[model samples]
Structures are given as C-alpha cells and as structure tokens.
Target chain A: MNTKELIKANNDKRKLLTKETQKYYEDMLIYIRLSYDKSEHETEEILTEMLDHLLEAQEDGKTAVDVFGENPKQYADDIIGELPKIVTKKRIKYMGMGILYFLAALAILSALFNVVEHYLLDLNELTYKIYLGTQIANLMIAIPIAFLQLIVILHYLRWETFKNINKVLAFFIYWIFGLTSIGLFFVIIYFMPSFGPLIEWNVWFNLIIGVVLYVLARSVKSFI
Target chain B: MSLRTQLLKGILEGCILAVIEKQVVYGYELSLKLQHFGLEVSEGSIYPVLLRLQKENLIKGKMKKSPSGPNRKYYYLTDEGQEALEDFRHNWEWVKQPVDQLLDRRDNL
Candidate 1:
C-alpha cells in the first residue's frame, strides 16, 4: 500500500485509543520528533515504544480511576477507598514534618530563654530578676504559636487557597511570631532595668529568629 | 522504538519525505500511510514530525480551507526535501547493505 493508505489505517486505529493512552502517544511523539532526525524504520520503532508507554498509561489511569471511583474528592473523603491509603500516608508525613519543625523552633526558643536570663539579666543578683519567670511563660505561649505556623505553611503548600492568599497568611503568622518574640524580649528588659545595652549579638540573633520564622512559615506553606 | 528509536526518527522523516515526494498530502493523509503498513502510529503523532521537517526547510506546507472546522495544512516535499531524501536513501542503502550481506552469508553458512 502507499504511504497515505498506511497513515489512514494507523489513524483509524488511533481514533479508538483512550484519552490517557492518546496523551501518552502524543507526549512520546513530541519528544521523539523534537530530539532526533529519524528514519522510517526508526519511526516505526518509536511508534512501538510509544505504544508500550500508552498501554502503561492506560493501565495506570484505569487502576487509579477504579480504586478512587468518580468523586473521591478529598483525602479524608476517600478513606474507605484503596487509593486514600497513599494520600493518608502522605498527609501523615506532612503532619509529622510540621510537628518536628515547630518542636525545633520551640527547643531553640527554650534554650535562648535560658541564655537570655543568665547572660542578659542578673536574675540571681537583682530583685527585678523575679520576673525571670517570664522566660518559661514565653515558651508556653510559643508552643501553640509554632503549631499555628505549621498549619499556615501546610495550607500554603497544599494550594488550599490562591497562592497569594496562603502567602499573606504565612506573612501574618511570621509577623505574630516576630512581634511576640520581640515583645517578650523587651518585656524582660523592661522589668529588669539592670539588663545591659542590648548586645550586637542579641539584635542579630533576634533578626535571625525573625528570618527563620519567615522561612519556616513559607516553606510549610509550600508543603501544604 | 526502544532506546534505538533515535536512529529511526531520521528514517521516519525519510520515509515521510519519500511518500510525500509522490503526492501532496495532509497530516492525516501521511499518518494513514504509516498505518496501512501496520505501523500503528497515531494521527496526531505525525504533525510534530512534519513541523520539524518543515522547520529544517526539507518540506513545505500550505493551508487549505476545508468544509469541516478548521483549515487543513497540507505538506509537500520541496527540492531541499528531495535532496535530503536522496541523501538519506543513499545512506540507508549503505547501512542496509552490510546487514543484508551478513544475513545472506549466515544463511549460506
């Protein structure tokens, strides 16, 4: 048969192909055509290779659709379905990572609290040092704030809202963390007058904390 | 095509050019030619290859209005395409000669 006839036959068969399979064939063809100059025999070989990938895509799509059924929308909604297990596993991983992130922040904050008391305030030496109780107070407040930051980050990453909306939420979370940290810092200083001129290192440390909170909040947003 | 598919793309182009050399054809028409021989390539699959061939100045296409939806683009081999086809045809002969000869020698042995 002539080339036109051959092409017609191939196209007719192609018309019966499923959408996912057709997409696979189209993608493979695009790559093949773009990458190299090929011969007719080679073209046939590429088509065969594409046929394999198409079959694979068809199988995968079929399995996914079958397991998930039609409207298994959210991960929670699909708990009864087979595919929800995978989504559940991923969600669990995200939750674990988020908890770890906040815990790390709290751990650092707790350590810094102790350091500020010993180095910045003469708590043992002065009467105002009575308010040294505020360091533990800061830790108590920070633990919950850290949890909120994690959620905000997760929301951003998940694309639950428009990306810009998530970003705004992340910004607010950081602002709260930053202002609170600063407020706590100055509150300690306000009560303890003997606390020396704020050290260059302390200012830098606070700035670093602000930046870390900003980054953590943004990073979590992407994860959500 | 497997990993060896890269070797066939040029050959596919040569084949398409050879086919178009005989007649002006649309994208669908060319795909039909591949299919008739049991090659099983899809209809939309050939357009990108056609576009690449045209970009290399090997084939030229013109738009023709159809009674259906959109204008159909038909491609024909240019002089440059013919020259490339001839060159590919020559290289193909040389490449196949050794393989054919080996096969023949094996049969005799």
Candidate 2:
C-alpha cells in the first residue's frame, strides 16, 4: 500500500479500536489515575499504546481479552505493581524536598519576625516583651499554614498540566505568584491598626534566605 | 498473581532489554517480537516494563517521525542497558543449572 493508503488504513483502524474499546480504556485510565495519581496525558498515552497493541491483535482476529488477558483489571494492577523502583524513590525524594521547603519557609519567616520585633518595632520594654510573646503565638499559627501551603504547591506541581513546561520555569512561575501573594498578605497584616505594633526589617536576611532556598529547590529538579 | 505471572514479571525486564538490544523498535514492534518469542505478554504489560527500564536508565526512547504515521516513540538500549543485559546473562547462567536440575528431578518423579 502507498503511504497515504497505509496512513488512512491505520487511522481508520485506530478510530475503530478506540470506539470499540472506549469503555475498557476509560476504566483502565480511571483505575490508574486513582491508584497512581498519574497525569491525564500519561494515562492517555498508556491507553493509546495499549490500543495499538489491541489493533494489531484485532487484525489477527483476536479479541481484547485474548490480547490483554482474561482480567483487564488484574492486568492493569500488575502493570502498576511492576513500576520501577526509581518511581517510588523519586516520590520519596520529592516528599523530602517538600518537607525541606516547608522547614526553610518557616525558618525564613521566623527570622523575618525576629528582625521585625527586635529592630523594626518601636515600643517600650514591656510592650516589646508582649509583642515577642504575640509573635511566638503568631508563629504557632503561621508555621502549620506555611507547611500546608508548601504541600499544596508541591502537589500542584505534580499535576500533568505543567508537564510540558520546563521544570525550573514552572517552579519559578508558581512560586513567584505564591510568594507575591504572601508578600501582599504580610503587607495587609502590617497595615492593620488593630493587629498591634508590627515592624518591617530593612536587612537582607529574608532575601538571602529566600534566594538560597529558591536556588536549592531549583537545583533539585529530579523529582518534579 | 499466579506463579506463571510472577515468573514472567521477574524476567520481563531482561526480556525487553534483550529485544531492544537487537534493534531499535517502537512499542508495537517490540510487542510483536515478544509474542514471537512465545511469551504470552499483553501489549499493555510491555509498557510498564519499557517505562521502568527507561526510569532505571537502562533504555532510552526517542520520538522519530514516521512517514506513514505520526511520531513513534522508538526505544534503544543505553550503555547501562547493555551492561544490565550482560548482568542478566551472567545471573541467568548461574541460576539456570539449579532450575534445570530441579525441573529434571520433578520430571523424573
């Protein structure tokens, strides 16, 4: 057959296979997504690859079960079960980095608060002591929130939607918006009159810490 | 999993590496070759093996344009894959005798 004819024939076969096996493909994809939290593109690629095999088998007069085996679900489970050890290792690594980001964020924020209280805020000794206690109280609330935010960001990064973008670029874009929103939040907190005395530090500790963490996070791109 | 499936799972990675070692092949062709070797592996099952091999740095896949079709992801063995195949060969040789002896004794029984 000519290339055109072959292409048309292959396309027709693929369409037919997709239509006939749509339900199985969808089910398998759902199972994979639920089990592994894989991206849609990933699941689709797998389904299409399997369909290619199914098409080849169909051409040979075999059914899906004949080609895939008696139990499709079991077949999928086996496939996932046999995933490379590197996948798990990488995930654990990401989790580790996520924890580090959480801790680094907390450290930087704590340092920022210390500089603000110690140098920036204008108050008497007693009020300053009160402010320090309040700052400690504020951290108790902020640290957990920061941790949760980092986790959400990490999870969002894993989504298939960002798969096409360069990892470093994607990470920067997400954090640029994230850190900006956070900066705005602090600005709002700074301006609140009823929120008690607040101070802003002019030193470069926060910037330095932020830059160091950003560089460290950017360098460890294996997990993302 | 059944014993047969378990055994197949154990060797499937080496088998796939061996197939890619012979020639650069895409997913469909690789599946066909596996079938030709009398392995009753499903087309779906081969992908996980391919993915895992790629992850382990044993194989590398590149998308090459096809004249009659869209880009096909073709796989080739990396140096690591070659080294892994060599290791599998050595390990298989070591295990083969005991396995053969066990099977022969079963046959005799």
Candidate 3:
C-alpha cells in the first residue's frame, strides 16, 4: 500500500483491538509517526503491519504488550533503527510545504483581525493602520514560537506515548500546551513600529494579500 | 548478553533469508515456519530482523491482498538473498562440525 492507504488500513484495523491494546498500540503509533527523520512510507507500512499483528494476536487473547514485548519503547526504537531516513530532496519539499502553510496562516489571521477591527469602528474612527510592524513581528516572533511549540508538543506527545499513557490523556495534555503556546506568543511580542514605508496594508489590501498568499500556500501543499 | 541471546539474532537473520528463499511469506507465517523447525523464539522478534533484511536488500516486501481480504505485506528474497543463503550454508558447514564435535565430547564426559 502507499503511505496514505497504509495509514487508513492502520486506523481501520486498530478499531478491532481491545481498548487496552489500542491504548498501547496507538502510543507506539504516535511515537513512530511523530519521529522526524524516518521514511514516511516505511513507517506507516510498519505501523499497519504492527496493527494487523496486534489484532491477530488479540483474537488469541493477547495484548499489545504481549505481542511487542514488555519493553515497548526499545522494540519500537529497534524497528525504527532499521527503516530508511527521509532523503534530502523529499525533506526539502516537506519544509517548503510547512513554510508556505505558516506564512499563509499568519497573513490570513492578521487580515482577519484587521477587517474585524475596521468594521467595529465608526467611519470617523476608521483610520488606516500600517501593519508592516505586525507583519514583521509575526515573521520574527510568531513563526519561531509556532515552530518551537510544534516541536515541543510533538516531543511531549512522543515522550508520553512511550509510556503507558493513552491517547485521550495525551490529547488533553496537548491542548494545555497549545493554549499556553498562543498565550506566550501574544504576551512577549512587540510590534516593529510600522517601519516599512512602501506597504499600505489598508483593510482590503490585507484581505487581498491574505487570499492570494493562502491560495499560493495551498497550491504548494498540493504540489508536495 | 548470554550466548543464546547474542547468537540468535545473527542466526535468525540467515534462517529468515533462507525461508524467504524457499517461499513468499508474511511476518506471522515466517514466524510459524521458524518455530516449526524448533527455533522457539518470540514471534515479535521476527519483524526487526525482517526489516534488517529488507534494508540490506536481501529480501523485498510487497503488499498483497490476502485470502481474507486485508492487504498483508509478503516478503520474497532477492538475487542477493540467494547468494547470501549460499554463503550462510558454507559458513554453517564448518561451524557446525567443530561445535558438534565439542558438544559430542562434552556429552561423553
């Protein structure tokens, strides 16, 4: 199966597992899936294979721990160690997709706020604001913070997963980190004082740029 | 690690390649074949070894629809795998004699 099909089969087969087995297998699933350097195809392939094996074993009254062994983390790591790494060309495509997505997201968010604030004011109060400062601050602070948050949350999930912790608990833990990450973003950031003289960033201008960039970002995603 | 632990991994790699040479098999079926021959190791350990074999290009896996309808990955040996099994047989021939003689004398004692 291709990587996407493998993922679907893995998810479908996982439902056959007992609740306890599903808990353990999904942890291995997250740990293996979230690992940065592994080949995506092989990773998903192995994950599907593992789920199939676990399901069959469960039919005979075995748990995931029984099928994979007691030291689940080591078993997973050993399997991961054998799979190929993502090659450089594909890695570059992955990064390109990520960069476009974030750039589009920040622009769209800024445009949204600008439109909402403009509508809230009376025409007398509707003054043009140069968002050059906000845009620059977003690139400087927001991107890095968002990237850092992604890494931290993925790492946290992987770490928690390697233990006996289940998915429901891991998800709630991620929610707390997510809220804290956004809160951290707003509190520490200061605008760059609207320094760029060339860009007007009027309400419609922001809206247009946001839409165009979002389209560009999504096309990049489809290209990848 | 104990002698069995140290040697089983290396020996299992050869046996796995040999089995794949004989017939196309999935992970569980291959595990059953090994056990039928008295290897008696945990079934889970087969996957890591199969992964290593695939990485080395001694075996290649393809997803095939099983009789039961799920797509299962089946493994078959490459040309390189046939050569590897031959080399393993050659190595085993000499290793077996000395080890057997030593064990045979030890049993006499």
Candidate 4:
C-alpha cells in the first residue's frame, strides 16, 4: 500500500479497535490521569501513542493482551512506574508551598485582627491589658475562614480556565474579588452596633489601612 | 517480569538512542525499526523512554509536517545522548564477556 492508503487503513483499524476496547482504554487513561498532574496535551499524547501501538498489534493479528501483556493495567502501571522521579518531586514541592502559604495567610489574618481590635474595640486600661484572651478568641474564628480562603485561592491557581485567560482580565478578576472582600468586611463591622457595641474609628485612617491589608491578604495572586 | 523482558527494558534506552543517533525518526518509524531488528517491543512502549530521554536533555523532539497527516514529533539525539551512547558501547563490551561465559556454562550444565 502507498503511504496514504496505509494511513487510511491504519486509521480505520484504529477506529474499530477504539470501539471494541473503549472501557479498556478508559481504565488505563483514568489511572494515568489520577496518578499524575500532567497537562491535557501531554495526556492526549500518551493516549494516542498507546492507541497506535494497540492498533499495530491488532494489525499483526495479536490481541491487546498479547501485545500489552496479560494484564494491561500492570503494563500501564509499569509505564507510570518508569516515569521520571521529578513528577512526584514536583508534587512534594507544591505541597510544601501550599503549607507555607497557609501559615503566611494565618499570620496576616492574625495581624489584621489585632489592628482592627486595637483601633475599634472600646476598652478601658484593665480590659485592654487582658486583650490577649479576646485576640485568641478572634483568631479561633478567623483562622478557619482564612484557611478556607487560601484553599479557594490555591484551587483557582491550578485552574486550567484561568491559565488560558487574558492577563489583564485575570488581574481585573482578582481586583474585583479583593474589593468585594473588603466591602464585606466593612458591612460586617458597620452592623456590629445592633449585635454588640459600635467600634470607634479614627475617621478614614483605620478604614484605609484595614481595606489595604484585607485586599493584600485576600488577593488570589498572593497565594499563587 | 520475565528475564527476557527485564533484559529488553534495560537495553531499550541504549537501543533507541542508537537508532535515533543513526537517523532522525518519529515514534512510529522508530518503533518499526526496533521491531525490524528483532527486539519484540510494543510500538507504544518506546514513548515513555523517549519522554524520559527528552526530560533528561538526552534527546529532543521537533514537530515537523508530514505528508499524509498532521504534524509529527520527530526525535533526534542531543550531544548528551551521543555521549551516553558511547558510554553504553563501552559498558556493553565489558558486560558481554561475563554474560556470554555465564550462558555458555549454563548450557554445558
């Protein structure tokens, strides 16, 4: 056969094998995908290469098991096993970074809480001296929320859609979320009078600092 | 794994590098050449090795237009790969004598 005809025949055979071995291929692909953090293009390349080999085996009158060995899953596992060690190493690096980001986020949140408390809470000298207990209580409430926000930001960092987004648009999205978080903080503090006591603000000075810190701490790019 | 399969796995990297060292080829063509030389390897099995080689900077792949289909990733050895092949040749010579002697003794037994 000429090259073109051979190509067509190979493609036809591939289509037939794909129909017959759909579940088999899916099982292997799913295993690989879950086991690695490979990009979609890399994943597709692997699948295509494997399918081509399977088609060639079929053309040679050998079954999939004959070419891929008795257990195709084992073959797939062996292939993954032989992959560069850097894959797991890179994952560990990301995990380390995630932990560091989490700790840094907690530190910033604690500092913000201290600043807000110092400026806003109405306390006499005795209560102010004992404010450590209140600070710890505030931290108990704030840490979990801060951790949840860190997770959300980390998730967005790995998001494929965001990677494909325009840089300017992504920057705008981060600003929007940052501004919204600051606004939400303001609303919560403004309504504090009905639930408890109103906070004393030094006009716009404390508000400006609070908003700046909140935005910096909560920005998606900070965690990324 | 069977002893033969284990042996194939060990030598496959050198064999692939040797092939690409001789000529620039894509995955499918490389697999065909390896099979033609009586190595009983699956066509797809070469890719993981290729990926590792590329990762280590021992080989590089370039996308080139093909006559009958989409662009294909053609591989060629880097300078590092040439050095690796030379090392393999020296090691193979050192290994061949002992391995042959062992097989010869086993046959006599």
Pairs of residues at least 3 apart in sequence or in different chains that clash in candidate 4: none
State in Å the error of residue A208, model 4.
20
DockQ for all models: 0.01, 0.26, 0.69, 0.15
Model 4 Cα lDDT, one tens digit per residue, B48-96:
7887788789998775675657456688899999999999889899999
Question: Which candidate has the top score in lDDT?
Answer: 3
Top candidate when judged by DockQ against the true structure: 3
Instruction: Specify the CAPRI tier of model 1.
Output: incorrect
**Per-model C-alpha lDDT, please?**
0.53, 0.65, 0.79, 0.63
lDDT of 2 at A125: 30
lDDT per residue (tens digit) for residues A26-82 in model 1: 433443332222333334433432343334334445422332223222311211111
Q: In order, what fnat does every candidate score?
A: 0.00, 0.57, 0.60, 0.23
Superposed by TM-score, candidate 1 places the C-alpha of residue A183 at a distance from the truth, in angstroms, of 21
Interface RMSD of each: 17.2, 5.5, 1.0, 5.9
| Backbone-clash count (model 4) | 0
lDDT of candidate 3 over B4-102, digit per residue (tens)? 877878899999988888889888778779989998877789988888888899999999988878788999889999899999899999799879888
Which residue pairs in candidate 2 collide? none
Question: TM-scores, in order shown?
Answer: 0.34, 0.50, 0.86, 0.51
User: In model 2 chain A, where is the ten-residue run with the lowest total lDDT?
Assistant: A123-132
Chain A TM-score compared with the true chain A, each model in order = 0.29, 0.36, 0.81, 0.34
Compute the lDDT of residue B76 as modeled in candidate 1. Answer: 77
Model 2 has a clash total of: 0
